[model samples]
Target: MPTKVKPPPAVTFAHPSEAEIARLLDFYGVRWEYEPRQFPLEWAEDGRPTKHFTPDFYLPDFDLYIEITTLKSSLANRKNRKLRRLRELYPDIQIKLLNARDVEALFTKYGRRGEEMNATKAEK
Candidate 1:
């Protein structure tokens, strides 16, 4: 008798930055999924869902969720707030946010410039 194993699902990216991250992860031999699951962060007083969040990537090998933000815009701030609430609600979930500076550092560590990945989408 043999056990059944499921194949990895195809990863899709809604933004160019996310595609770049997938490439970087692949280069490092790390498997990653894009917005694989949504986490509920808030519920209404009547038990209705008020808010939910889906992180950018899930690195199963490391058991971590990676959220990338190339800008300091209000949307990013909102996402940050959601992440905070998510953390408070699910303290056991492993997650990290990779802001512009962190992304630059990651590229530099691999002898690549963050700017090389199209400054149009990257942070200034």
Candidate 2:
């Protein structure tokens, strides 16, 4: 009988833009991982995590985390609050928040608009 081999875990992107960013990172030879770790921003009295924050990308080479948010005003406000809390709790961890405008700027630089960016295959 042949030994069964387990397949490697598939990398899933929560949004189309994440896939676009992955392509760019691959092109630049900048190794990156998607949501490699989640930091607990709030804990309950039982020591369980009540609130957590996860950055979109983690660049091993840069030793930093990049959070991409394309949410509207209200959602962005909430995201910003979480980021602030994450920073406060984990001061040593380096992370950056890339808002929609920043991502748009990047798209413009690559001559790939938002529509084209969404053309890339993404999970969820």
Candidate 3:
């Protein structure tokens, strides 16, 4: 009897930029996880987490978390604050934030248009 093969699970990215990043990582043979962990940034009076920040990719080989943001300036500023708070709370945690311009450059280098960076959200 032949054994049944299970298909790999599908990954859904919050933004097109994330998918591009995944492709780049795959091209380089780097192992990565998408939104694997969330770090609590704020706690309420009752001790529950009020806010959390989840990075886009976690590279196990490099022990690093990367966040790619192509949002507008206002939204990017919020992300910056969250990153700052996360670093303050977890100084040992390694993280890198790729801003809009950085992401654009990456896309350009890889032959992807800047507009495609955030063209749509939640793409499979």
Clashing pairs in 3: none
Measured by lDDT, the strongest candidate is 3
Task: Give candidate 2 misplaced runs (Cα > 4 Å).
Answer: 1-9, 112-124
- Give the deviation of candidate 1 from the true structure as CA RMSD: 7.0
Stretch of 10 with least lDDT, candidate 2? 115-124
List the pairs of residues colliding in candidate 2. Answer: none
Please say which candidate is ahead in lDDT: 2 or 3.
3
**Candidate 2 local lDDT, 16-90, one digit each (tens):** 878778777765568898898989999999999999998999999989999988858887889899999998999
lDDT of 1 by residue, 4-120 (tens): 899766666677777777767765678888888999877899998888989999999999999988677886898889889999999999999988778768777876543454553
As a whole number from 0 to 100, the lDDT of residue 96 in candidate 3 is 96
Clashes of each: 0, 0, 0
Tens digits of per-residue lDDT for model 3, 1-124:
9999996578999998787788767655689999999999989999999999999999999999999886688888999999999999999999999976887687678765534434432252
In order, candidate lDDTs are 0.81, 0.83, 0.84
TM-score of 2: 0.80
Error of 3 at 120 (Å): 24
